[model samples]
Target: MSAFVVAYFPHLCLAFGGLLVLCLSMARSVPAGFYPVTAGLFAALPGLWAVAGPQGGSPIACFYAGLLSVIALATIGLLARYAKRRGFAGDALYGLLLWSALGMLLLADADDWIMLAVGLELASLCLYALIAARLDDNLGTEAALKYFLPGAMALAVLLFGMALIYAASGSLEIAASLAAPGPLTAAGLALVLIGVGFKLSLAPVHLWTPDVYQGAPAPVAAFLSSGSKAAAAAALLHVCSEVSPEAKELLWPALAVAAGLTMAVGNLGAVAQGSVKRLLAYSSIAQMGYILMAAMAVNDGGGEAALFYLAAFALMDLAAFGAVGALSAEIGDRDDIAAYRGLGYVHPWRAGVLAIGLASLAGLPPTAGFVGKFLVFGAALSAGYVGLAAFGIITAVVGVFYALRLLAALYMRESLIAHPAAVYATGPAATLALGVMAAGLVGLGLFPQTLLGTIAALFGGA
Candidate 1:
């Protein structure tokens, strides 16, 4: 029991913290500033655990859990600020964020099918509520419905796949399922991949991402793009790590095709979007495609590359969305890319942060995103997926054109209409958040050796 507690302490802290916050939210006449303080404390708990908690799993599991904890805390801090600015009251939202973070932690440490499925459902349900928390917005409600329907279908498919695997292997352990080979097992793996593919927004099944991101609140969209997507990618890595050589022959080719198509479709789709939020949504799809190349590699080096890239993507993407949220509050039109015309002249700090984010997203030099892409492509090439690596490079170049469009609007174009009365207003909290993330992105890009060495150790142990 002590060992178990040591291994799973991060999950326990988040779960207990969530329940405590939920209880506090039910009390009447709470103090004015209690929730934010409590939120800071809750966020701190995970970071502390990441440093001090006992590590008992495989090196990959430990690395993923630590990374997930850090990302979750960063996301929660950003969401708390966004929620406060939006006049969202009560501790309920914070509690749900903690709950979702706990679910993600569970997924990171999951060693068996049951735990993975449980974590997936828990995180999905909490996100459904979070997306629709703004009940007054019809678009929010509609996006929630759209997200829920597909999520529910994916959950069902995942459960069915697990059941089939159990029947074939007579065991529910992930490694055991992989070791026991049969036609049923292969079919089950295919079904499971399909389900996870939807969550990760792989092409063909990625139809829901843009509409949902465009409709949901910007902070919620940020969480979906960063923390939630990272968790799903970790789960994919966990399952794929156990694949047999024969299974790899089939799975690798399928993943390669999916990665190629996802990159192509995502970049092409982003080129046509008029909404900043929608464009970022499409950009995330392409980012996921790059990460999937690492997944396709399915080795220690690949896992390291995937983990590093996910961390980089989370910071840069969150910074981008944070800038968007701040500007949306001022402009009142979250969807219009045109609203950002001449923003660089008017709001240099915010524009600079957004530019850094977009540059990183485009894989420009001296940014973590560029390092991540290099590692991911290297992993693919080393794993003998040279064709996929070449295709990913081509699509990444295509992505730059769309990312630059937003920058062009920010710096080059003149505003077609008069500015709103609130156009100059800025949220200090959001700005601070973006500044922190932007700094982190630059720091990682310039000094990546520390992180790379840490990842190398973890992968070596795995």
Candidate 2:
């Protein structure tokens, strides 16, 4: 019970913090930016503290709390510019974001059927409200509707699966249920996988990715990409790992198919996109394909590989999003690739940071992306999944072309259009983030032995 409370305190703190902020916001007309900013920071602190606590070193159950802490901080940090520029001034909005973050934390740690459902719903409801927070705009409302409808259906599917698992095992606990999942439990697990698959944007169930990513604000998209998706993947990995070894055979094929198809579809779809936002949308889907492959690599050191890649993936993504935030602010929210033409010449610092980020995403040398992919590829080789591993490497090579294309545009001949003198200030926070991410990427790439050693110690054989 103490362990449970210790593990669960972050969620409780978030709930309390959100409610307090809500009450305070309603009491008076605070400064336009005060509510959300304060709430966001306050909300993040609990999770940070929790993750850094003594018990965060759990082995097999994974770093459920700590991973979430990194995610919370990253998401909040990525949204700094977006929140600042948009003037998300309400207490409600901040409270919602905080609450949602807590919910994500809970979802990652869910070990019981009821807890999973509750946590997921908590996060989903907050997101629905957050999406619709764009006051006086029907478009935001429409996006929220699109998000909610499918989200609700997904939730229903998840709940039904949970119920079926419970019925088969006569236990709500994940460990007990996994001891022997009969046909009913297997079916239920499949349904739950579908539900989580939706959250992570795994096809053929990922129809909502483009709409949600495209329609949502930049920060929201970042949050969805990092926090929400990370939590869902964490939960899925936990559940699948806990299930019977025999059941894993049943699961891997589905995940493998989903991974391969999503990678091909996402990358191919991204090829023609002019909007950076849309391009990133497809990029995220492709990234998820890699993540899914790592997940499916359970027997073949998949778990360790997945964990390694997730850390690297989070860093690269946040860096990328940070660049986009700065770039968007520089050009009045112009997300078109055309606006990025010759960006290297005009905004050298931003372009450099973005280049580093793209390089990592492309899995090029001397970046965290390379190390992460190497770990996964090594795992695949060790597992003897030669074909799957080859496919991943090939796709990674293809990704290099698109990533280089961005760099080419940035550095190619300067655009004739007058460059804006006042580039969005890559203010202190952005600079700090970019620097930290850049150093980490380079450090990990060059001296991967240290990172790999840590990963092996933490996850046992990476």
Candidate 3:
């Protein structure tokens, strides 16, 4: 029990921390800045996994779980400022965030079917509520409904797939079930892929992402794009890595097609967006395609590439969305591209942070995103996925155009807003959080070896 608690300390903190925040809400007078402080504490609690005792969980899961915590902490930092301004920084929102983080951590460590199912539901439900937390916002509520209904269908399909796989293999372990070769297993894996595809916002099933991201609060969108998607990607990586060669042969072509389509759709979608949030939403979708492309080459260093990209992708989205959350106009988010004209002149620091994020997203040099792409493309080529790598490169170049559009809006154009001062200035806490993301992007880009080496070492690559 002691070891179990130690192993799952991060999980425990998220679960209990959520309840504690809800309890605190009943107090007559609570400390100012309490929620963010509490959130910071919860985020820090996961570090105890290394310090307090023996590590009890899979190292990969622990790493991903810790990453999720950081994402949640950053979301809260932005929320600390964004929510209050929008009149929705209730204790309930904070509590839900912790609980949702709990689910993400659970998914990171889930080695069996039931645990995976539970984590998926917990995370999805909490996300629905978080999206609609702004009771008065019709768009938020509508986005929640769109996500919730489709999500429910996806979960049902996933559970059914699990059932079929279990029946075929008589095993609950992810690897064991997937390793079984049969008609049942083939069908089951296909269904499961469909479910995961929807969850990950893959092309053809990604219709929900842009509207939802546009409707959800910017900070919540940040969490959705970064933490939730990272968790899903981690789980899918585990699934892909476990498949039998027969299973791989069955699903390989489908996955490759999806990867290409997702990249094309996402980049093309971004090019048409007039709203920054929608553009970021599309960009996030495109990043997932790159992950997929790298994942196909897991044996040839693609797993490490995917892991590095996931980490880099999360930081990039957080910085981008957090910047948007910080710079909302008098009424709400400045979603329109025209709204950000001359933002660099008015808020140099915030705009610069956004530029770093976009540059990274564009896979430009001296940014984490660029390093991530290099690793991904290298892995793809090493695995003999030459055509896919070339396609990804082309899509990446296309992706740069939209990011540059946003960058031009920030610095080149004159301020369109009459009262630049009226725009919500980012609070210190949120600014600091965005700074961390920007620094991480550049730091990882410049020193890619540390992370690449660490991932390789963890997976016994070197």
Candidate 4:
């Protein structure tokens, strides 16, 4: 019993915490601060497990569990501040966030296709509710409708793919599905990729991303962009790890093309966007393109690169969105780039963090984003995808233009309107979250060798 407990403690911790929050949510007079406190405690459990040395699953699982914990904690922190500012009171909102985090934890640890599907649906459903939580906004309702329709379609595709794999191999285990390959199995794998691609916002299926991000609450968008996206990428890495050589021949080419298209579309779209939230949405799509490039390499080195990049991207994205959330809370959700005119002069600190995040997203030096792109492209080059690597570099340069454009608006452009009676102010809680993420971005960029060595060792052991 102790061994079993040790093996599954991380999942159990998150699961139990989620259930506890749900129960509290049902109470007639739950404390105003109860949700954030419990959620923060839940978020700490996986880090505690990490500190004690994970005793279950592979080292990769431990890494992902730790990653999920960090992302969840960050989300909870941002959500608490957002809720406080906007009077967004609801125990159900906090409960849903915890439930979604639990689902992500489950997804990261899934060993079989069935578990993967369950986790995906669990997270997806909670997100739908969270996105549409603001009952008064028609735009939120529209975004929820757009998100749900495609999500349901993706789920159907995933289910059909799973059924096909089961029929072909008579087992739902990832290893079993990969061990035996027939035409049916190959088709199943393709369908599965399509489903995962939708979740990751890989192009051709990513139309929902910008609209949803633009309409959803800023804190929710931050969580969606960082935590949810990282969880999906982790699941993609797991699925790709089990692919047979026969399957690889079919998968790699499709992945390469998708990567190129996703990068081009995402970067070009960001350049055209006038809204900060929409711009970040497109930037996220391009970042996923780079991650997919790493996935195409299909080896342990590739997986390590993908995971490292995901961590870097998560921190950078959270920093960017946290600033957006703070600004929106103060400025009445006027997320237009024009609203930010001369912000660099007025709100220097917040603008500085936002600039750093955008610079990092552009793969500028002295930020983890640079290191992440370097590792991802290096993984591709080592795998002999020279043309694909070149394409990625070109798209990355395109990404730079838009990022700098945003910075230019922050510093160069003059404000067209007068300041409101209340000056723009970021709360201490939100500021702390932004600072932590920025510090992480710089720290990871400056001293990545230790983390890289650890990732290498973990992969080697597995």
Q: What order do you get sorting by lDDT, best first?
A: 3, 4, 1, 2
How do the residues 166-271 of candidate 4 rate in per-residue lDDT, one tens digit apiece? 9999999988887787888989988998998999999999999999999888878888888778888888888888888898887679888999999999999999
CA-RMSD of model 4: 1.7
Q: Which stretches of candidate 2 lie over 4 Å from their true place?
A: 1-5, 29-37, 40-64, 136-139, 449-455, 459-462
Native-referenced Cα lDDT, model 4 = 0.84
Candidate 3 segments whose C-alpha is farther than 4 A from its true place: 48-54, 330-332
Summing lDDT over every window of 10 consecutive residues in candidate 2, give the lowest-scoring window.
Answer: 53-62
Assess each prediction's global lDDT (C-alpha) against the native. Answer: 0.80, 0.74, 0.86, 0.84
Q: What is the lDDT of residue 231 in candidate 2?
A: 79
Stretches of candidate 1 off by over 4 Å are 418-429
TM-score of each: 0.95, 0.90, 0.97, 0.96
Model 2, residue 219: C-alpha shift (Å):
1.7
Candidate 4 residue-wise lDDT at 107: 75
TM-score of 2: 0.90
Please, what are the lDDT tens digits per residue for candidate 3 over residues 257-354?
99999999999899999999999999999999999888788866799889999999999999998888777744246689998888887778888899
| Prediction 3 global C-alpha lDDT | 0.86
TM-score of 4: 0.96
